[model samples]
Target: MTLHRTAILCLTLTAGAASAEQLADLHLNIVPRTDAEAARIASVIAPTTDFTQPEKFEDNSAGAATVRPRANADAFSQASGNMSFERELDFKLGNGLFKKLWVSSPSSTLASDGLGPLYNARSCQRCHLKDGRGHPPETADDSAVSLLIRVSVPAPTAAEIEGYFATMPDPTYGGQIQDFGIAGHPAEATVNVTYSEEAVALSDGEVAHLRTPTFTLTNPGYGAFRDDLMISPRIAPQMIGLGLLEAIPAADILANADPDDADGDGISGKAQIVMSAVYDQPMLGRFGLKAGKPSIWEQSAGAFAGDIGISTTLHPAGYGDCTEAQTACRTAPDGATEVHDNAEIGDDGLTLVTFYSQNLGVPARRDLNNTQVLRGKQVFYETGCIDCHTPKHVTHRLEDQPEQSFQLIWPYSDLLLHDMGPGLADKRPDGRADGQEWRTPPLWGIGLTQQVSGHSNFLHDGRARSLLEAVLWHGGEAAPHRQAVIDMPKPDRDALIRFLESL
Candidate 1:
């Protein structure tokens, strides 16, 4: 009787709330053949302890049909949890483009040539290994395949904003310092980094040591850089749920913006707005360390141009990453623009690659019923951690974009900029983000960083080797939350970490 009653109730719920339909179908193993039927079944699906409870698993994790719990080192590499069960071939195609190695022009391989006159890594997978976060160099000789330094000199006059000078590209170095080049060309320069340890005594009589890195250049192959060179270090972040994040409507994102702390809360989360190169209209910047780029499409094209030195339709230059100062490099052969109608990676390539990027699945939450995680979840909210690391968002509806259509998600971020104080400041402005400000990075899949990326380093530069170190370094708006964590008993702190790991 109990089993029979529950089934009938679930059927009723599934037919009532279309928003919960994806999971209802998963739990019931019933596929509605027609759109109308599917919506009805999804609408009425009732909640259950094992499946339907809102907090039982992450909201996005609930609807993810392809959720992989057993796979690690590849956790962040899965297709969207809700990815149609039958569309794996498209996923594989995107994965191929993601891992394909680009080569220099004048090569026998027509499809793969046009790698670089100057570049960082040969392929996307070189940096975002296993589709996870990149780590800082452990040693000077370590190939910084995953790490790159962004160089700029102050813009004498603010490009658009008053009292704020935008970045000016170095006449010789350009926007970034590329350390690798084709065989005939010399590598740009050698980079060396050293860390100085700073210690902090917690209220619990425990101490945490923080490492700060200082970068130095040696054996300049290009030439001298600007005396006022503003250098910023950035490492590649994970590539899961990017489409979902991008799908989160700009209006929904702005609904969380509190730039003036207008609500009397100390946390001031400001949205970073930048004019889009692709659209020529101002759009919210959602990707990159500083939230510098607007759309996933542009971000991908920018990476193709900047990181691998492969020119695409957006960046049609044949001399990838080469400035006018480098004459031989610019004149060198280029396949993307020279041979491929002014674009090495044509529309097809970009579409396939972008499609693959958009579908990377977020792994399901583990141990959601665990007691420690539950306690930490509460502490996360009570101690004001939720103020900045916001949770819960119902994504927007996008017609014809089924992969990224209406769905509930929990990215644990406001996706807005916050002043992180001096400890984390790159002192470089991007669009509306100030030097000390950075977009609050989403915390989903952060727990699996070591499993996926082979490292647990965090923050924009990967300086925080552990999550706690990342927390302790917080200041400005997040200072109070940091203080709360430090003041908590070891058990509570452990519980908080447990909650984060469950994500």
Candidate 2:
């Protein structure tokens, strides 16, 4: 189906009744003006170190040294002058085992200490392969089914601090059945999709086709489920330059928080404050669609626990939905509750895995100087896409690291949550974020996601089949921009898409 027709159908189903001019006026002035204010507003994008020159310390300087310290004099001096670009690449390249851990496992493996008694995927790589994009649903069998599940209980009114698991309780097994299971057990769940097709007539006399998804679970292993148990299906997101994202200072992220809609942009960029499992303190979340976790270490660790049933220092337990009748499951240690005999295989392994994921170098821009790409970049900014997809941030200085030293990097995300409206709302709260809010996903290496991750599914869930569909799905703070995109001429629209592909 043509893009214009599909957008019209989507609009017919859920477009707000408000007029265009009124919607445009909303949040019009929310964007920062001067570079200083923009830098302050997007402090998260500021360079953490003065990278114009190498740093010097008063105490470290040797007075009037005619010659540098020899190798025999100080090992530090010998190591300082010599740099190994090859070693740096080796360090940045992910360990083969970690890559295997991210990729090789299935959603149902029983490794005594790994895989899942209950999980969304067997390996981290299964969801986010090569740390790239996932394909959206095309066929019934091939549709993207794995999505993040969220559960929340009411906050306590008293002064007592809740226990770790108290705030977020696991859903009852049958309530949120794992679609895949171990060898002996029945596949606990099944997802069925029914599409309702809508056709729209465009201004150019062309037709656009769109489909709305209706989900149903058939032959559930457990009995009937609760309607109140909110379900959210999130397709895996691309993992690139996450280390730099983690290195961004917290003060920088907070400088951009506009929680109360104070400026009335309708696009309130709120910070989701989450309890960090690693830091053991409340932190401003910068990862996940809702910005639920503060750092990549915790995010990777939690995924290991929740998605792969791998226990680490952070999450020291496993989860499965087996009845008392299932003696083997009941008696057996379903998952690793602590780091086992292999000290190296525990949190250290997870840390290395995170480092690999964090440090996966973003490839250089492709077709950057091309006319189509340049036109697309202009259209991208002119259509107000740049509001959320703010495009550059410099990294903090790394102590003792020569290769990862301060450098300007372009990861097109504001790293803050904005209301995506009902079109994309999963109706589930995560950390401090409301049901409708989602973090603006980074756009670096987005064009190459299909080659790397093997899929083109965009957004939190694999709802949008293509980038155009993904753009059409925008709403809430992005509704005006989405409409503007819809209303653009075919050439302009194609230019915008070409620009996206060039990214």
Candidate 3:
């Protein structure tokens, strides 16, 4: 049986423990259903619905703007000169000077431009290989290639919020901490975790136990950091169909926000509305956990500046932390924002890189027609997993490609925040999201993750070791679905997991 069987039993026992008077007031379905009756019971467990259907996007503002072909027409001609220009542009973006500027070329000097004083990885491709999924560490001592770094403001108490600043102060380490440095300087910091034991009683009268994580920083390279400072760690997410997501109109997203559960479905899909500093407008955020930033342009610019300490048009200032001991780092020239317009290296490099990221195609589905897959899909929906993991969404047309227009896509995510319960909470506030909430991660290309990322870790911090573990770890809003999954027969449970692998 799955881990949830115990949870169901616990609930039953708690329900049974009420006082006689309280029990009299309670309603119960005491008789067990027969096999035919069980099938009827299962029928009520609705198939996972595709929440990304047409109705979800009908109200979007940009929904009315039909995707058009690229503004650059001459580039698509079959002429040799056009082909050559295309190749040249690709070369420039992929491996030329532009690549050197946007991506850190390990062999180049920091002073030569584009390399970093502080960085997580040297290149964009390092974390997101070929724009594919990033796996977590398989073993504790393993070198972390693709990892998520989280950032947050410390949660303010009511008293502090009333007396001082309206919001929590930003950390000295701007958003993220770049642990590795160029050859000369010491690395920024190191993270280590120690676990404490915890126990819980299961319905089978057995104790299923686990460990709790406690984090500590060693050799505080920066000195006396605040104990109550906010911290966020996030793994790099796959980059596919981001442009299509951006094309989705804000109205469509807002239409799905039923924050008060007005639909009475017991599931409230809320929207995280954020102010886009780049666009200078309140936009529906579809990216990031809190959906704080708007477009990929802003996301990329912020990553370059915050992750690598490299400045671009959007972020003019380099990372601003300094100590007397790190004199060389303090002396490095901060990159100017308008370097693209004025310096030899212009925005040409950054633009092409962004294009490549935005255009990385989602691979075609592999096992849709298989019997096991078909059955699994049925099981997935029947178990009510589809309530949140909505299956299909149609992409808006790409202006550049007539062939790629209006394609029906399947990215299994609702892109809404759900309370994930205390087990997953980092206890920090980000934008409009509380500590316990997280965006639903899309489940496309998940089957290929083990092959591409070379690890099985899942979830925000890579805590779950397998898909089963990931499901078992779900709580809060997912508790009901998790229970249903546990109560399923062994064959059906296996079928459901097989269905996930076929993704």
Candidate 4:
């Protein structure tokens, strides 16, 4: 295995597996970025540094994959700068699978067939649009392709909580509320999202109008949903530096956890621990809005089965999440067969897609040194947003995984769950995350969302229209931080936003 060693970082040999626009368990490490010469990278590599006392200086290479700087509509598509030639070929193949549109079952195109009897989108790239985050529909008539609802009910104590996560999938409608079905089959329901705005006056008399969304299940093509069902909405997140996020050591993440707020910081970050079939034990959930998934592989496989209705080894059900209630839908012809061992998406296809997700480059910070951006960075720290959104992480040194190997990264997230308060709550629980708890999402490629996805709507449910709105909505553990920002002068507020834009 080939490894890239450097003065400030060590990139493990990127063998495979891994992302947003994230993967089935793309378990990858990251390399470091640097302006230093090749001789430095090839010889006299430094040992890993203590994350507790992390380096204060912002080096050019903010860890390998977490910091690639591309400023264009196609910014999110670039692979890591130091990717090996061999892996670049794999990245391209993975890109093909990532962008490959799946057709309905029993199609002539076998490699790309077996779309859902019920599904939200045809391809991964469609929802992730240019490998960036997705947004909510602008109007009720607009397509909800990128945004989907998760339906569930309070789970009885007798219900399984291990491998099969908590919450009961709607018996008739299934776990996900799919609005689009295959040619003849009717969709489960149409998602009608309406919002009522409330003005929040800041200390400076600046008002931030917050739009709270109400999702109504309209035009139920199937049977009526359970009377007591609960629904949660989610938008696809950007695909950048996922491998590096995955490589962060569990201890380092856990070290930052203050589940009980013992330090009097008011910021209690709880790690989302869920049952993992990949490691055959409980592991920290690192992907998804709630961090309900343990690895990118499981996350990708879940998306294949849930989002696209394409079954994989992880989710072998040929019915594509269709419950017994939907009998005909379950009985419909499937893409899986005796040859593929009842998997709609074969291992090879899953592998290719995972590889592509594992290596999506982290766009370099555009204006890290700018005056306003720097001030905003200081403001961000002062406001305590960095408490849950922890700034730096070093990827673990896994064997043959140098691309995301031991290197410093600045994803600006702790990957821990925090109570975001009632304003952003979905009133539905996922794993251990209550309705109001959400994983601190990474802020690496956010400033480029508009360049790639054409919209900047944010938060798990896409209610926050801008970064400021997103911050203003922070409550529970982050309420004090939000208040600090609200109390800032206009120039400071603008500087804070400018700093966020620099990410």
Candidate 5:
């Protein structure tokens, strides 16, 4: 194998079956770090202990790629700070495609036709508003632009069941219930959510209310679902520092995977392995709420097909997610043309969008030196949140991706799957993630949710109304950490939240 000696060392340090060959396949585009470079990286990424002051470069969350934080809703919409002028044009062009709305096919808009026989949103920007996080519908009249309900059934055949990764899409409705459709086609279903509130008393006589949401599909366009149908609700996550996340060596991510919790830290973060859509090999899952997609390219292509019903080279079905049972949808006219590589959003278009997504720079950290923020940072570290919300990672030196190359980034995620317990469970397995398992989402830019997205709803389904509520919802591996917050004095709890907000 052509694996670097340092990479081999990194792999041997981890407990997994990932051979050097598999890692080499994933790092094809990256240059192997030299022994000297590896040593420097080890020292750089080590967790800091000096809480009296902010660590070196703590405010630059994405290193050279970090953009200046904006004062308005466009804070999350900037390109990489390190991107070149020539590349910025491509980013702008990609932004245009990302925001472009598609109409129904058989219209005069040949270049932009093929709006989906069934879809949840018309454009990427529609769901991921202002490049920020998405929220669930706020009221009965609110449109479900960002939040989507996913539907799948248990593997039917014995062989499929034994295969274990064989969770199948619904026969008639397909993988997701698209709430919107083109002019003539009917939508798959209407997603209905009702919440019940429970109040918990914390230390120092403070109370926090948590909302438990029950989701159901009403007004099904296609007939009834299977008896064993499983469903999950997902909201669009924030778009920033994706290229940096992708550049984190798979060996580094795997090294954090303690599937059995052998050391007994009560936190076992398991790697989610999925077959790569582009490379056609088992790769570390990194994007999506459950870390289902392996790369941003695949993730972007998937959203194009699943969210907007626009086909790309990766997902060539012009009818989008229409199942064989939906004859009218399958027969609908698509925007495929020979000039655009026979897909609505061709390879070039998809590439541009992916480029835009990969370069969306994370905003610089705020209030790092604030006394409360610093105290909260100490509280956060002592509380053992770093076990899963790993504070730092160094990206590989990529010959192509200059912006994300060899930089220490603070995404505050292990990118590993952990069981969040029944309280947060959707009971729907996604690839390697069980019902209760969710990828530890990157906490960077979370403080700006209200500033950028105009709301602060969070978690996989937007059930959490505030950062405190989001923490209270943590369970399973994070239950002890959550209890720490609940039991800590109110000052420390407030500081912990302040420290989180500074991120």
Candidate 6:
């Protein structure tokens, strides 16, 4: 093998096989931090104690990449604030590709064909509407455009169980349920959900209703699912500050991990490790609801193939998630050609989309100085929410990704997997995330969910109708925090929500 290939192989093996402390440099293009620069970063990233007023640069959650808050639904659609005009063009091009609608193969559009014989959505934008969070179908008639059901089965053998990462796609239905299919092809399945509500009384007689969602797969195209099939419902999270999240050093994230609860903090965040499709190496999984994909590129590639049924270099299969059992679907014509690097969407296309996703600018915090917001901020911090939802991190100085490099970003996430208790469990093991574990999603642009997504649904399965409902669903490691909220004074609880909205 060539030296470059050997190096890559070694990196892949070492990162995947070794402990978190032994993690090698997965991002090779980064510039190492100087001692003085490192000291400054350490000082700035320290958790704040004084909550009398907003801390310095607290409004700029994405640091230099944060955009000014807009008073419309397009708030989440801006490019990185620090990006150059030349790079802005690339971001727009990526936005176009992101919203590009694909059709079935043998169509006139050469650049946009090869849609799934069986698929979920036509484009990335379909799921992540307006670059914001996606909600579950509101009514029975409403289609599940943004919500997708992931189906997997238990590994029959121990060999397939690699560390915490174990589970394979259902034998007949494949990885995810595809609700849409081109003509002459059968779609995988249709998803339906029924919810039963339970009212929980709070400290000051305020009752919060939590919905328990029971997802059902009706009208299965192939056949009955396996008895032991594990299903997980996922809603597309908002797209902002992803690049900043990716730039956070793996060691810093791993430092927060206490899988054994060694710190006695009741917050044992575990690092989700997965093989990177882009680097061909093991990387810290920071994206996806379960922290499955390592990098934005890999996540985008997987979405392109899995969600849209569009082939990319990373996932070259033309039929997308179609298994060999679906002979007709597998034999379907694809949009692959030599000009497009033998995949429907080539490297250039994928790179452009990744760039667009990476630079989705986070909006600056709102109402940082409001008395109630400040009180809520204190409540949030004092309630131990910061134990898992870490507030600040200094990103690596990168030679290439200038927009995300060396910036102190407030993603409000440690990007580590935490067991959120069985109340919020999906009962599906994805990569390093167990059934009850989920990555602490960043709260940067969460306050604007209703403004941008046209709804206020939160959580992995969109079961939480409000932020408080989402908070009440927290279990396991966050049970104490949840109880604290439940037992807090009504004014303090209201302030806490106000502070979260200011984010």
lDDT of 5 by residue, 364-445 (tens): 9999989999999999998999999999999988877889898989999999999999999999988767899999999999
Off by over 4 Å in 6: 1-21, 159-162
Task: Give lDDT for model 2.
Answer: 0.54
Compute the lDDT of residue 363 as modeled in candidate 6.
Answer: 95
Quote each prediction's TM-score.
0.87, 0.73, 0.72, 0.87, 0.95, 0.96
Q: What is the C-alpha lDDT of each candidate?
A: 0.73, 0.54, 0.52, 0.75, 0.86, 0.86
Off by over 4 Å in 2: 1-94, 101-113, 143-167, 174-177, 185-187, 199-207, 318-330, 334-345, 400-405
Question: How do the residues 398-488 of candidate 6 rate in per-residue lDDT, one tens digit apiece?
Answer: 7788898888789889988899998898899888788999999999988999999989999999999999999999999999999999999
Q: What's the TM for model 3?
A: 0.72
Arrange candidates by lDDT, descending.
Answer: 5, 6, 4, 1, 2, 3
Off by over 4 Å in 4: 1-62, 66-68, 158-166, 337-341
Candidate 3 ranges with C-alpha deviation above 4 Å? 1-112, 135-140, 155-171, 194-213, 320-330, 334-339, 342-345, 397-404
- The Cα error of candidate 3 at residue 496, in Å, is 1.1
lDDT of 5 at 493: 98
Select the stronger candidate by lDDT from 1 and 3. 1
Report lDDT (Cα) of residue 327, candidate 1. 93
**Residue-pair clashes per candidate, as listed?**
19, 15, 14, 29, 0, 1
Q: Which sections of candidate 5 miss by over 4 Å?
A: 1-22, 157-165
lDDT string, candidate 1, 283-394, tens digits: 5667888887766778888899988888887788878778999999999988754456567787667776777787888777777767787787777778887677767554
Which candidate, 1 or 4, would have the higher lDDT against the true structure?
Answer: 4
Residue by residue across 1-503, what tens digits does model 2's lDDT show? 00000000001112122122211111111222457654653564432233222222211221111113222211111111223545434334334434454212232432334455555676665666555555435576674434544444433442122211223433344223456655555545566656776664433454465556665656756555555555666666776566656654444445456667677766677655566565444445687777767667677777766666566666664443344543443344454423442311365466556655555555545555567666777778777776777665544444533333444456677788888888788776665566788898887666766665555768886666668878887899999988787777777778788878756
Q: What is the Cα root-mean-square deviation between model 4 and the actual structure? A: 7.3
